[model samples]
Target: MDMATTTSTATHTSLASVTLEVADPEAARRFYGAFGVDTYIRLRASETHSTGFRGFTLALTVSGPATVDGFVAAAVDAGAAVLKPATKSLWGYGGVVQAPDGTIWKIATSAKKDTGPATREIDEVVLLLGVEDVKATKQFYVSRGLSVAKSFGGKYAEFTPGQSSPVKLALYKRHALAKDLGVPADGTGSHRIALGSTAGSFTDPDGFTWEAAAPPAPTPS
Candidate 1:
């Protein structure tokens, strides 16, 4: 079944904001605030019957191991459950955490060592949707006028965001994403998330919805 009734198709979409549907908006707001990511996403109340992996994750690409560790620590202190501890791997240092509201987040970096003092600075925030078929989903977004910035055959694809976009969009195989996040692959019901953009609203092939909305106002530094 479709997650929600989508209204229109997306065109020239750049991910301006992401909204997470939570059961407790106030609690979520508190958690995100303590975790230092409240400014990156919005929240709404919904008792959506979502379970297991939601087929997506918000990935934080930061500077180095220290930064990754710093974010992971903050999330844990903010009431997030750690799915994986920050550690160095073939890719780099990173970890996974499930927010109090059931959203999964992966904090990672390509640099294995600390370059300077740790800070709450995010280099890039990518919204990765786990899809059944990477190629088909990539084509769907392409038809919607989202330009492809990176493609790895059937394994993954990423879209180029407009200058004003706050988040970048990417696609990966569903099962693979779950494995990467150290979670099981099976899931059902609402994704409990929405992507906001300048483009018109539409549901993607994987049931992820994009809405017509302005980007989030820039938060004071």
Candidate 2:
């Protein structure tokens, strides 16, 4: 792998979008669109499919269903434990699965949100982690007082540590996560986890970085 030549054009904040390399372009498009996300770009040969949002983008690329199946199989073959086999959800179209790395992937339609006026109030912040082992990582955090909100398989998982003000910490396999971020997997540990309040840092089992942050204090009334 070329180390020095790594360049990323993707510029978005939070947990942007998890891109899955699949087999069918149209099917993947329709699958995500059904979740209410608009498909902005589609490329056949490059197998690139992109969905746009006000602040982020989710992408998928595949030749067809068979190809997607093969990719899933490859993950399993590579020692990735399936957290959830690819299956449809009651809420909408798409499927959910986990990899051995504790990365949970939801290959579903875009999530639909009720229209509302924008406010200064924060909605959510996404935390990303690269781990050597997903299962062990999940256990480490859970033992540290974090609660598992959801687990897909060995590939990915999500933990929520708060209620009124929520935080989402996601764990992903190093290599697959590198591909999603379009970067190299050699740099493990917390790449960057954001918090909505006072900024604080925590280290996971793999020495990944994590943050608990808040906006700067405001002037007294």
**Top candidate (TM-score):** 1
For model 2, residues 1-221, the per-residue Cα lDDT tens digits are 22121112221122212233434545545443432222222212222322211111122223333333444454455444443354333543333334322233333222232244322222233445667788788776665455566676677776543433333456777667655443345532222222332224556666543445333334338
Off by over 4 Å in 2: 1-124, 164-166, 188-202, 209-216, 219-221
102-173: candidate 1 lDDT, tens digit per residue? 999999999988889998999999999999999899888887877787788788888887676668889999
CA lDDT, every model vs. true structure? 0.87, 0.41
